[model samples]
Target chain A: MAVDNASITEVVLGGTRGGPDVKTLREDKWWKLPLVTVLGLSAFVVYATWAAVWGDSNFFYLPHNIISPFYSPCLAHACKAAGDTGSPVFDWWRLSPALIILVFPLGFRMTCYYYRKAYYRSFWRAPVACAVQDARPGYTGETRAPLIIQNIHRYFFYAGLVFNVLLTIDAVQGFIWPTLHHQLVHGQYVTQSGGFGMSVGSLVLCVNATLLWIYSLSCHACRHLCGGQIRSFSKHPIRHKLWKFVTPLNARHMTFAWCSLFFVAFTDLYVRLVASGTITDFKIF
Target chain B: MADVTMRIWRGDDKGGQLVDYRIEGNEGEVVLDVIHRLQATQAPDLACRWNCKAGKCGSCSAEINGMPRLMCMTRMDQLPAGPVTVTPMRTFPIIKDLVTDVSFNFEMAKRVPAFNPPPAPEGGYRMAQVDVERGQEFRKCIECFLCQNVCHVIRDHEDNKAHYAGPRFFIRYAELEMHPLDTNDRRELVRERMGLGLCNITKCCTEVCPEHIKITDNAIIPLKERAVDAHYDPVAWLGRKITGRKKRSADEAAALRP
Candidate 1:
């Protein structure tokens, strides 16, 4: 039997299933998608790396009480240098607060089901596009060491939920500004707490928080947690309801993943610009 | 109409090679139409499998220009200029010409446990539109096996075929798993026997889906997450222990195995 499995074996495995040596017989612009994926992901990674390490320590806009999503739950003592009051528990650690806080959210995004597809195709070039030969041949996938660690994605999802809560707190705090009026009544100057207000920065923070919440909630792990293990949805009404609410969001997880990623970076840039006096914090009220 | 050269694979189990055939193909014609013209005029012995000549039948699946597409669906004009190369699906052993033995898929299909729904209520099985719609997306699959052909697990390594059910059956499992009324506990089945763990989810299956199903996002990832919940989740394990709503025991799971 002279089975002609040669064409695919040649393309996929670089084997002599019986075809000519060719990168791909596909003549279309198949590379365009992988190229765009590389550019887009690389841009975000570069911007995020810059914002994390090299940004002017102005991640917190004091006037508007808006903290960058990158710097939210800012726990490091170095945050005080950035004019943001962080917990004394972490006062010992001296480095970028963004670095400490980013690991959880970064882990969440890195192990994300959608992101796995993006990076595997764009970065690893594992069959870069459908029917396209992979850059390298040996394939073990997530079943083995290193890649098997991706099974901890749900734990990261838990950590992401905690971060989402902290960021939501930061967004709520964005609404409470320090009143400009200073009082000397008690032999000490005091700025009254401005009760409730809104600003462009606050709105930005709110949107960032909302998007992050949606992204986290729309996670496949989240959807699974809600209703996956159960044999019957009718038996678990509460979990079923939660699953129902999340199912639609889960469908658009990819959209939220990109939109939230871009907005988080944009929110940081907005805070940086305002804190650096490059742009004024526009008050909507 | 213009004369177009098609470099198609011509061989049986023994061996074959790409043989070119110049035939008159119309601008509006599809690749299948071109093949039909070639079969009628040039070579009557040319073996090709097709039914309905429509994309819906999924019978005319082959690798056209290194991409798995239905011959009925690929328009001649859409192909790039020069000789078009058509080959049999590489995942399966070739029977003759463009036809390959797809019995592996059928064998895998038979291994899947039938949908085991719970006894219907007095009013019958009622499901929300959203719940039904979730499974509906998976049902759109025409079983063209493009996803199976493109999947790296079985494509690159034929040895994985025994354990791995490929993407087509994964969606089948997902559809059954997500069925609101299904009572079959398939968590162990998916992980152990069906080879869900082997899937790295590169999404080649999702990309090649002719029906545009979100195979990776809607089906595979969710199934992976479900498997995670079953075996890996610490919190879920704790809850199951406390509530005494234990997962299927190892003995129970083994009994259900083929």
Candidate 2:
């Protein structure tokens, strides 16, 4: 067989497989995922302390900001009825706390290439993940439990990405809206953001979303799924350019996985800070 | 010299039992050397398969002391202080003692189509170094059948044999798909018909691979993604519609005439 040594080098071990730039992140505290996770949780302690001294917030600036344009009744006319009458009531403090915890899995889910890789590598090999010799016969059957959840990563990715976009939009709303005081206005103690927590929350959310987006979009499986078009894409000028943007993210999909993981932790921190009131609801937008 | 105990499975499809033998060992002795000693003196009829016991050819796929290990590479001292065990691969049928019917692997190999190269350009073929690098992971496959033995698709669903082609074949499929000089439309074949959908991406094959090939990340999952793109991506379908005609014409001209 006239095995081309060039082909051997190129075909077997080429492309993103040999990128030499893994020096910075792979060797850091991140690889100690346990420590990152512990510290990530520990950040919550700081958040809790900050919240207890201050007070929880409900950052809703511009109380009349349109939440659901589609549901509003003023769309039929010139629509000049906006005076804080129809905006949906929301609790930014309560929501931020809930969102903090919810965002971790979302970020992990968004950028998780390892889930699929591990699923196929670890789960597929079954009871024989390791081989035995001269001992009792090994079972060659499918393994069960949490391992089986590997199949739905695609769907999970979709959910996390969508939630990221939605949360970013929420962050945007927080930026544009105004904060509230314990307005004895209607005497119901109706709390809302007249000018407080929304701006910082929105900024935090944007950074959080952008990082998570990079991590999720840079995923290895996503790259492969799209890379199928690499050959045909080479000829098309437009797709070729688009794929270039995706290439770096796709190349270091694992890096994105770790980056987005920490971002999610940071996102939860931001959400907790906003909700718990450790950081004053300056609503600085 | 030190004494080491071994439990060897000795039997056929009809019946089977573990037979023990004690052997003297020295430091730095390889498992293959110990097995050779056992075969030379005591159990002459013992059947085992090996070639290039240096770990290059990948022929010595066997489980050692209940762990899938290459007998050629495993050292006796690395094992726990007790009787070591040896057996044939589990996914494949037992052919005899310490040897299973691995012909299923070759049979699967036979099912894979021969590689077909794309048409040469008028000036000749060209490919980038960066483009061809990732395929090296696929090409290094030693055909140890360790991947096949470790695959849950084969181990869990023996009935999967009818529908599935297992991990090694996926490596083959991924290699061809990623080949810079090759031309084939095996992605849809691998995905829909070859049971690429069945691989949940556990990474057991990659973990056990002595070559350290990232079988799951570099090969199988990429192949699966190709399949998904081929089958589902509208843009890919469009690209194929645009380019498929030219490639098919070129392939027909260069490939063997039917």
Candidate 3:
């Protein structure tokens, strides 16, 4: 049967109608996804805010020198010497150390391809699921001001790489515990010594760094960086190989995104507990 | 004799429900074949839209067992031992038993600017093998609207239909923008009017694509990158301001020479 071209044109040109005719009739567990996303993102936001502002217990185990991921590269001059090993590059601001660097990582997550879908559905109700109707009257899309910033995700990916390097350095520092060996050299006595050993804190930081690396590498931006620009995959054998390798990870970008998010928070919490003497760091030789 | 139960949707715009029909199955039958059988033996007036019984035409797209698939491509034997449910694409307004009003897609197509290539050179315009291949991947689109139906931007959000152009046209825009000999600049139109940013790269469109087009990675994301480079990049933004607006390159002008 031939499709009525005239009718199709009439309907096509007919301007925006109201909402959908049917809301949804899906009987199987539709609410679960949005509920989990809302609760998960809300918890992360709350915890991150509290942790950033609490200030005192962010740096723990001064003698052992295991710094929290949140306060790493602590730039405030007022920060205690234990976590301030990176030195205060900008001493003007004495606020929460996380405030300065948190934007980079947070921007990375907020603008992430997967997370955008997660939050858009959960929070914005931009069609919560496959057959569900949206609550909004009109769809403005990302063409306008704030939403358009999402396009800058590739730039955030670049900034995220810098953070990954700094975090990896923190993880390496976890393995080197301070020893009690102080001697006067010139006019100064070195209060701490360093040796290679593993602590539970070190393991936590290591796992955090590893998960983050996987998450960042599996990013859509990174996948695009690897091969999206190439016109033909056959000519550039190396880029083709890299794109193929990243494809599987890119397929599971959502899994890595969530796992890395949970692990980052867990790592921060572990350091905070150890710093506050709430938990003991088990050392492993 | 092996038999299969087909629960086809029977409804219209106001409301509808599933109606079951039991039919005898053959060795290598597809869902469309079964539907055809049902039309022959059981229900004569049972309405559904289809042209080519093959998958190439993309006219027989429907949700088979709750997943978007071409009815002609979905094999009966591949389905599990249960009643196979067939329904019209959920994104559009149901017109009858299994047909949807897909005019929303045509409207979006109309809204996009037509491919405006520069005037041809003396003989004809020359295109490199690589440049042609880049646009070729997108040209394979059959306008199945499966990508449009599956996209949550317009699928779930009914209002989004006005602003968003869905995946089908994103590839169209990508095809025109990526063409080497084409001189029109659609980055601004793509970003502003076409609502390119509405897509968050969920890859839902890619998953449901019958042609296996890389809707998210190749077309959508690259188009997004171009939009960002033209509109957002600090360096590009500075260059645009300093250089004023860009005219067609000398090579592009030469290609258009009569």
Candidate 4:
């Protein structure tokens, strides 16, 4: 085939050389998207910070013992005496319990494939929308100091899986209510004669866990883990099946990401409200 | 039998407008065919770039009805019954009607390190079928640059053009890096120079690829993994540090392998 370099005319009609000279004359609803992203992300961050700092009342309903998603696996000495169930890694640290475990979930979201694009456009204004000029004059990508840590997303993913397991256990614990009678089992206080029932908190935690699972499982890293390195899908039937299952979720990864983020904060807020005696945990059963 | 209202963009760098033209459509004609007909009959000076009128040439890339598609491949019958809007790609600087300056892609191509293979064996360099198959998908790229045009890194952010290499060269890097016989550590170059970290794997580039190349899943993600392994993986970084071994040249690694 004859290479057609003729069409690519190098007519150097000079003005501004690097970027688009003419500003986009688009009258569409382009600004709404980035604005929504900024508002949503900002709200979540502000609420999360407040919730994380104000450590009291994060763990709720001592009878049901439903731990907030924010402070799950609450690793601090202070949590035990507050009549809340939490596995503290060290008793020495005298700080907000959320300080210990929030990093994993935060890192997971910060380095998330969807969230990266969201914040990069919304917060960084890296070409706020398609065909729009960015606020920055140049781009260095994620090669720099702090952004380079994004390459550790896979590791954060592993940490996220561990947190998911802990949160799932917490959700399951939300179901078992402590009776009038109690016993000691395996050097821990055990609740006996508990019945199967559900509360709004339990349902909220379940929904939060489910949504997070969907979001994490649908992650681009998760998809890559499922089927990326494999050269031949035909040879690996099991991986192929897994990939097929994940394909649909991967298609809607953005939806899952946003929904899970909101639900997580909601889950934490709900527990905080219940702990503070602001809202009653309505029983579903 | 029917006349299709073809709205084509016509103007230079100063300004442009979508000028409507009534062009007669044949029974089984593509969008490029209609443009060619318009060029021949009504508007002789209507500037459009195309070659090989078949899909292989990659020269006739333009957005038809707000979607990036090859002019030769997009059949008129497939479109809805209305005026078809044809315009230059949004990513690059438009030179004229339906023709954007695609030199950005060429400039990125130059920055990629040339493939350096080790000295051939006693007879010649022999590559396994599996190794060859790995790069086959990427090699299908005809340099249409539809991937670059649709890529949000550069397409959305014009400034990103300075840093990001877009999807096209990432595939090129993948082909060279994954080739069994070839040896070159372009991971650092991909990380720093080509701006591999910018791709958030929206899969928009993959979606728009005419050749159906899994650009995100195959090329970009794997390149990311390689970069992470080289630079970020703590154990690997420690191992590299302890051994005091720099990146081996193609010949050095090949000589040590046997």
Candidate 5:
């Protein structure tokens, strides 16, 4: 039944809700969560920025073949300085390769279903928490303008999978250390492969790649790609199988997201320390 | 046991006010218990709806302490000192004090396509326990509509209510879509007709869900991915064509059936 005549009257709601003009009626420490989120995410951003831009040179360890995930697929001309193979195609590019490669994975995380919530609540304060007032009175969300670009998350997911593959290759290469074999062919000297070996740097890179793979596979888009559209699982057996495998992973996407994020930076730091001779890359073989 | 002051909203669709009531509240008493005591001793004409005070009925839903929660479940002692503000769910039009016109949710529920499983095999359709577990997780929903109340798509935007099915029904769609035996395709329905894209996946719905259903992750996000699979992904489209398999919508499948 419609109560058409009940006049909309302004009154003191209670607690935090002083009135209609009041932002929220929440009495608890509501700001704590958003504040923590801001600090955590901001620290990650700051660290990521430092690693990507300022510490670009120390991202590769030649003896252990440990490559930082941030500078992976080391396609720059400068990669040769670190004893990593450099692609001739990217020889013309002068800047840090991390800048070129980071955009893809960055986009993936920024538009992620979980990250969107984290940043939206913490950064934008778009109704920071339940029943809380929005920072902006009018909420357009991802419905318009720049935020609407989030529809490209699947594209970023695809891009992220490529990065995962590249990182996994880096991890595998981490197991192959440089040999002491020096040969004189004509007038030049060449070093031979150390074959299969391992180091502390190798384990760090391995864990980094593993976490990235888990994060990529556990992605909401990847999970969708598996069995999301299948009308009947009985028909698409392979997809159904893949879907089953990723379902549990997708549930822990948030954990993997944070773990992989931190581990990526740690992998970089480990590589940098070894490359700069700040720390020793102890052989584990 | 202590004296508690409750600032409960009182009024109708037009407007309302937070009317305070001081009542003798026990330590073990719930918000609903206090409201009942107030009704018995203090305010005889206080308007509020309640049933099955054990949190199962899904009634007695209100915004206690500015959080959408079941009044039956919120204990008196859990709340901090001073007045506990109890208000009608902000999402829907208030009918009276704590009651809202949750008929919006009912209308949305009616629009959800029914589960259309393929005809049962002989005696009965048997399934593995692992296959049923996913649906079981979604089945824990008690129709509290707290998810709906907290969802920003409809809660904030009144106009969006026409197109958006909100989180409650999104889970309903997800349940039917993910059902192993079910054949109905709701990808286009949810994406186009039900305004699924309007949901930015902020996950306010998940936060308020009393049943702890992963409404955003398990339900809405999966539905979005399914919609992407059908509408956006060229690879899936080509694969479907090469396989010569066309998944029909509910209408198309229904039209073909006897």
Candidate 6:
């Protein structure tokens, strides 16, 4: 039987359609896809800027109050006994302020796997989005600039990994210190100083964050993994392990990407609580 | 079932118009199959380019309606039916109906310096096995030029042609950069002359690739890293000076480099 014009139909028409001169106007070149990307990035700036002024300052407090929670829990108890509830309001202001300062970089952050993929598709054939050029097609598939930022994703992977490990260390410190015996017999809420177990646990959280960062950075299947490198891979002992670990991370990069995002927030939260007093840093004698 | 229409662009650059053709085939039938039937019964003069029909060889590149694709792999069922359009590669000048001048890529390939390995006669250069494997993965590239077909540097802005070498060129640069035995320094050539920084790593080429090469990460990215190391990293600068042997540049022989 002969197929008629009525029998077949075009399926797979890509992207949303609607423009002022839909039929007459040609698709725009070097299209800047106003995705949730640029706008969503701005949200980080707004939040970060607000956090600088309104949030806690304790995030910057490094190994001092934090390390004690892990190695010696009893001190937290003593500090808590001597603590004033009014400090929490000050602590909140201490921790979150710098994160607010970091908004500009986040907005321009080039570590996005999604942006890499979207632009690859967009510019290769549709720098004009999904719209096609009707006037005699005279184009070659290639990429253009601003794509230069892809170099940073690798560094981001390394930096994020280190940062997440530190965050986890901070969380573990909280759990560890709570287990330690506070020798502050004079304190209201007395507790014992935690043993090596708590210390180990805190370390585990730090390592957990590190793993999340590895997934974010080494992601092989993510959009950033789209290009080719000139050099063939060498079978270095360290390089081999990195690839194996990164493969799974790359396999589910999106999951880890979101997880670390929340992890960062959680890190900020713990610091706020210790500074504020809602979550007491009690000393056990 | 409705009849599927194909408005094929027929003619050389002199002038042409959309020539319509109709054929009967299953929805899943690839666009190449439709063209085959058209060849058998319709206008035989209708020119097309193809090879392994399995989406390999990178031979069957054309724009269906306006999108670049391997006609052999495109399914008839997937396209809209008002008039199923078939045309040649747009980036290059047309040779005839559905055939474009893709020799430009080949010509570009000629400009790339050929590979010259380290000249240690006794111990052929001891490269770590891991490093060799890294290069082999990118070496799997089949030169589909699909990445070239999809790049905006060539597609939207024609002016970039002078300075911007397409992704395929970068792949060549990358192959040399990773080769264990290669000893030519193409980093400056790739960065300053080849325009390596122009690629944003969107990976459109990898997406369109039939060979499944990781065009961006495996090739373009490593090349970018090399450029960085060449220009920014102190250790690499010293290493290059002491070695006397230049870093590897390409896999081709001396005749290949333009």
User: Which candidate comes out best when scored by TM-score?
Assistant: 1
Candidate 3 per-residue lDDT, tens place, B32-73, comes to 999999999998887878888777887887877666778988
Q: Per-residue lDDT tens digits of candidate 4, residues B1-258?
A: 499999888877777778899989999999999999999999899888899988898999987775678999999998888888887887888777788888888867756666777777798876556456668999999889988876767765566677677899999888877665655577777776578988766566776788999897678877887777667778668888999967543333222221
Expressed as tens digits, the lDDT of each residue in A87-116 for candidate 3 is: 677778767778887889999999988898
Residue-wise lDDT of candidate 6 within A1-285, one digit each (tens)? 122334222322121111112222222332455344344435544654444445533332221134211111111222233331112222333233344334322422344554455434443333433223323344322223344445455555445444445555555553533343443322234454444333333443464456455555546422223222223345344445555555555546546554554444454455445444455443332
lDDT of 1 by residue, A66-164 (tens): 888887787877677776755635778777777888899999999998898888888888768777776776776777788877889999999999999
lDDT for model 2, please: 0.56
**In terms of lDDT, which candidate is strongest?**
1
lDDT score, candidate 2, position B110: 55
DockQ of each: 0.27, 0.10, 0.19, 0.14, 0.23, 0.13
In order, the Cα lDDT scores of the candidates are: 0.80, 0.56, 0.75, 0.76, 0.78, 0.54
Model 6 chain A lowest lDDT segment of ten: A68-77
> Can you give the lDDT of residue A233 in candidate 2?
42
Q: How would you encode candidate 2's per-residue C-alpha lDDT over B39-149 as one tens digit per residue?
A: 998989888889898888887777776456689989888877777777666667776777777766765665565677767779987766546665677788788888887
Candidate 5 stretches greater than 4 Å from native: A1-21, A86-89, A143-148, A180-197, A228-241, A283-285, B117-132, B240-258
Candidate 4: pairs in clash:
none
lDDT of 2 at A193: 47
lDDT of 6 by residue, B138-254 (tens): 676666676786676555545556666788888777777667677566877777656676665655677677667777766776666666566645555688799874544333232
Global lDDT of model 1: 0.80
Give the winner by DockQ: 2 or 6: 6
lDDT (tens digit, per residue) of candidate 1 on B1-258: 679999998887677888999888887999999899899999899889999887888899898998888999999988888999998887788778898878778777766666666678798888866577668889999999989988877776666777788899999888987887766667767787678888878888887788999888778888888877778778778988999886664334334323
Q: Which ten residues in a row have the lowest lDDT in candidate 5 chain A?
A: A9-18
